[model samples]
Target: MKPRALMFTLFGEYIQHYGNEVWIGSLIQMMSHFGISESSIRGAALRMVQQEFFEVRKIGNNSYYSLTPKGKRTMTDGFIRVYSLKNYKWDGYWRILTYSVPEEKRELRNQIRKELSLMGFGLISHGTWASPNPVEQQVMELIRDYHLDPYVILFTSSSIVSHSHEQLIKRGWDFAQIAKEYDRFIDTYQRIYEEFQRRAWNNELSDRECFIERTKLVHEYRSFFFMDPSFPHDLLPDNWSGTKARELFFNVHQLLAVPAIRYFETLFESAPDRELQLNREKAINPFIGMI
Candidate 1:
C-alpha cells in the first residue's frame, strides 16, 4: 500500500478511535508493524499536512498530528461508504451529466472525466455521463475547482422513457467485472469466516491477530467504493455476488471487532481525551453497522 493511503487508513481505522490527535512518535510506532520506515512515515505525514489532510498540534516539545477538518469529513464519508454498505435504496432518478470541454482544453476534459468516473459516474455517450446517486455537490465542486463551469450542464431525470432500465444499466456499467470482484472478495473472506466459525467456542483470536485480520479485511473491502455504483436491487443482475459478499463482510468484521477492540483500546489509554473518544466509538460502532 502507498504510504499516503496507509496514513489515511490509520486515521480512519484506528487513530480516529483514539481521538483525532496522535503523537508523531506513537504514529510512527503504530506503522512499524507494516514495515514502513520511520523516515518514510515522517515524509508522508509532512506531505499530508501540505495536502491539508492532517495538521500538527504542539504540546511543549513534541508534535502530535491529527486529521484536519477536511480530513475528518472525508474519512467519515469514506468509512460510511466503505463499511456501512455499498448499496443504498435507489431513488427513481438519474443524475445526467453533459459537458463540452473545448478541444483546445483536452487535458481538462480528461481531468473532468477521470474525476467524475472516480465518483461513480458512468459514460452514457461522449460528453455525457450518469449516476444513480446525487452528484450535484461533487460535480459543482469539480466545475469550480477546474473552472469548467461554462462547459458543463447537469440534470436529473425521474425516469427514462425511451431506454429500458436494463439497457441503461448494461450500457453504463460492467456488471460482469464487478461480479468477478465480488467473487474474489467472498473467496478471500470465506476462509476467515469458516475458521472463525469452527473456532467459535475457543475464542482463540489474539489481539494482534484481530488487528491484522481486521485491517486487511478493511483495506481489501474498501476497494469496493471504486468498483461499485451501488445501484438498487432492480438495477443489478440476478444473483449479484456483491450482496452475498457484503453479508460475509459484516459477519467477519464483527467477529474481528471483538478482539480488535481489545487491542486498540489499550493504545487509547494514553490519549488525554481518551474517555471522550471511547464514548464516541460506542455511538459510531453502531453506524459501522456491525450486524
Candidate 2:
C-alpha cells in the first residue's frame, strides 16, 4: 500500500484526540505536516470510516469524523501488544554478547550501547552486555528500533557458565519463579502467534471494506520502510530461497507485519500509564532519531 494509506491506518484514531469534528481542512493541515497530499489524506480517511473505525458526518461540503468503539479498541490493543513484548519482567539474562574492537567506531559503539540499554540490556564492559531475558524477538526488534546497520557491528554471545542459583543470587533474581513465569508467557505468546498466523492464512482482506480494516496501522509500516530502505524483504525460515523465494518472502513479510502490529496492540495495553504515553510519542515521532 502507499505510505499515506499506511499512516492513516496507524493514526486515524488519534485524530479524535485533536477534535470530535475533524474537518477536511484540519486533515489537510495534519497531512501536510507529514509531507502527505490532500488526496491521499482524504482517501485514507474515507477508508478508515468505511472500516467502521470512525464515524464520518457529512456537513455542508465537509466531512467531520471521530473514532468508533472499534477504533478505540484497536488503538488500545495495538498499544498493549507493543509494550508487553518490549517491557516484560526483565532481569539480566545471565548472558553477555561481546565483540573485540579495533577502536574506530567508538561513537557508533556507544550509540548501540545506549540504545540496547534502553531496551533493558545492560553493559558489562566496553563491548559486552547481557540482555534481561531469552527474548530473541526483543533483541531483533531492538536492532530495528535503533536503526543500526548490522554489518558494522558483530554480535556473539558470551560463554560464561554459572549455576542458576548462583547467577540468580548475583543478579538478585528469583530464578525458579521467573523461569516458571517465562514458560507461561512463552506458551501464551506461541498460542496467540498461532492464532494470528491462522487468520493471516485464511483471510483475504483486500476488498474495499477490508482494505479499510486492514489499513489501520499501515502508517507505522510506511514510516518503518522509509526509515530503513534496506530492510530485507525476506520471509520466515519456512520459506527458504532458491528461485521465487524473494517474492514469497516480500509478500509474507509484508502481510506478517499486521499481526505483529496487533501483538503490539496488546503490549501497549499492558504498559504502565507513563510508559504507554512514551510509547505513543514514539509511535507519533518515529523520526526523532533513537531515544
Candidate 3:
C-alpha cells in the first residue's frame, strides 16, 4: 500500500478497532498484522506525533499513544480516501431522481441532494431520483438519521444512472479526451513513479519525509481533475472494475522509489541547473565533509 493509504489504514484501525489509547507493543502488533516491521511502525507513530495527530505518553520505558483532535481529523480524511480507493461499498447503482420542492424545503432538499449525489446518484428527472446502485443500508440510515420524510422516497429510486457529475470530480476521475491527455498524464505518472521508487531504496527517508512524499503524490493525482473542472461527468467513461485504479496506484507507488533515487543520482553525476546545483551541493556537503 502507498504510505498515505497505509497511514490512513493504521489510523482508521486505531480509531475504529482499538480504543483511542495505544502503546508501542500495540502499535507493533497492529503493524505486524499488515506485515510491516516494528521499526517502521515506530517511525510512522513518530511522524504522526510530529504532525500533532497523536499524543505520546511516556510511562517508564514504554510510550502510550492516543489520537489528538488533529489525529481524528487525519483519520476522517483517510477514511474518506480509503473508501474511495476500496469501493466495495458501492452496489453498482448510479442513477438519481431529482425534483424541485417547495422553496421553504429547497434547502433541506439541497442538503440531501448533495449528500446523495456524493454517494453516486444521478438525476433522471425533476423531483425524481434513482440510484444505479441499490442504495446501501447506510444510505437509508443516513436519510433517517437526517430525519428526512417519506415524501423523499423519490430521491432513492433505482432508475437514474449513479455516476453523477460530482462523484467524478470528487474522485478526480473526471476527464474529457483522455486519449489526447493520455500522453501527458502517462509521462507525468512515469516520471513521478520513477522518482518515488528511488526514494524508497535508500531507506534514507525519515518517516515524516515518506509520509509527506506520499501525500504529495495523492494531491498531484487528484489535481489532474481539478485542472479541468468544466468537463462533464456524464461524458467521462468509466471502467466497471472500480477497484482497478487503486490497485494500479499501489503497484505504481511501490515502483516509484527507484526512479526517485535515480533522479537524485543523476543530479549529482551531472552538474545540475543553478538552483539544483546549489541544492545538490547542500545535500552532499555533509557527506563530503565526512570524507
Candidate 4:
C-alpha cells in the first residue's frame, strides 16, 4: 500500500477510535509493520496536511496529527460504503446529471467527474452522468462544496421507449470487467482466509500478525469502492461474484478482529497522549458485528 492510502486505513480502522489523533512517533510505529518507512509517512502526512485532510499540533517537541473536518467526512463516507452491505431496492428511476463547467475551470470539472465516478455515476455521454441509485443529496453536496450550482443540472426521470434500463447500464459500465475483478479478489483472499483460519484455530498466529493481515485485508477490499458500483441485486448479473467475495472478506475480517484490535490498543496505550487514552471509552470497531 502507498503510504498515504495506508495512513487513511490506519486512521479509519484504529486511530480515530482512540481520539482521532496520533503522535507522529506512534503513527510511524504502526506504519512500520506495513514496511512503510518513516520518511515516507512524514512526507505523506505533509501532503495530507496541504490537501486539508489533516491538521497538525505540536506538543513540546512532538508533532501530533489529527483528521481535519474534511478528513472526518471523507472517512465517514468511506467507512459506510466499504463496511455496509447495499441491499436496498432500487427505484425504477435514473438520476441524470449534466454540467457545463467552463474551460478555465477545467480542474473543477475534473474533480466533479472524479467524485461522480467514485459515487458510481457512469458517463452516459459527454458531460452527462447517470446512476440508478438515488444520489441527489450527494450531488447537491458536491455542487454546494464546489459552488457549481450555476453550471450543473440534475434530474430524476424514467427512460422513454427509445432506450431500456439494460441498454443504459451497458452504456455506462462494464459489468464483465467488474465481475473479473471480483473473481480476482476472491481467488487471492480465499486462500489467505483459509490459511489464517487454520493458524488462528491452532494458536499459531500472533496478535501482530493478525493486525497486519486484517489491515491488509481492509486495505485491499477498500479498492472495490472505486471499481464496484454495487448495483442492487436486481441490477447485478446472475453469476456475480461480489456477494461471495464480500462474505469471505467479512468472515476473514471477523476472525482477525480480536487479535488485531488487541495489537492496536497495545500501541495506542503506549502513545504519549495519555489523558486522551485514559478518559476514552473502549473504541467501538465499526467492522465488528457488520454483515
For each candidate, the alpha-carbon lDDT, in order, equals 0.74, 0.42, 0.47, 0.82
List the candidates' TM-scores in order: 0.81, 0.30, 0.43, 0.89
Among residues 3 or more apart in sequence or in different chains, the pairs in candidate 1 whose N, CA or C atoms overlap within 3 Å are none
User: For candidate 3, lDDT tens digit of each residue in 114-232?
Assistant: 55554445444566544444445545654555566554554333232565545634443324443345445566656666665676666555544443354344444443222222222
Model 2 residue runs over 4 Å out of place are 1-16, 19-21, 82-86, 89-291
Give the lDDT ranking, best first.
4, 1, 3, 2
**Model 3: lowest-lDDT 10 consecutive positions:** 267-276
- Backbone clashes in model 1: 0
Each candidate structure's count of clashing pairs: 0, 24, 39, 0
23-138: candidate 2 lDDT, tens digit per residue = 55655654454456888878877787776666777766666666676555444333332222121232433434564434686766665654444333445455655543454554
Model 1: ten consecutive residues of lowest lDDT: 282-291
Model 4 misplacement above 4 A = 269-291
lDDT of 1 by residue, 46-145 (tens): 9989867799876677778888865675566556666654455678889999998888999879867766765778887888899888667877766666
TM-score top scorer: 4
- Candidate 1 accuracy as TM-score: 0.81
Give the Cα-based TM-score of candidate 3 against the true structure: 0.43
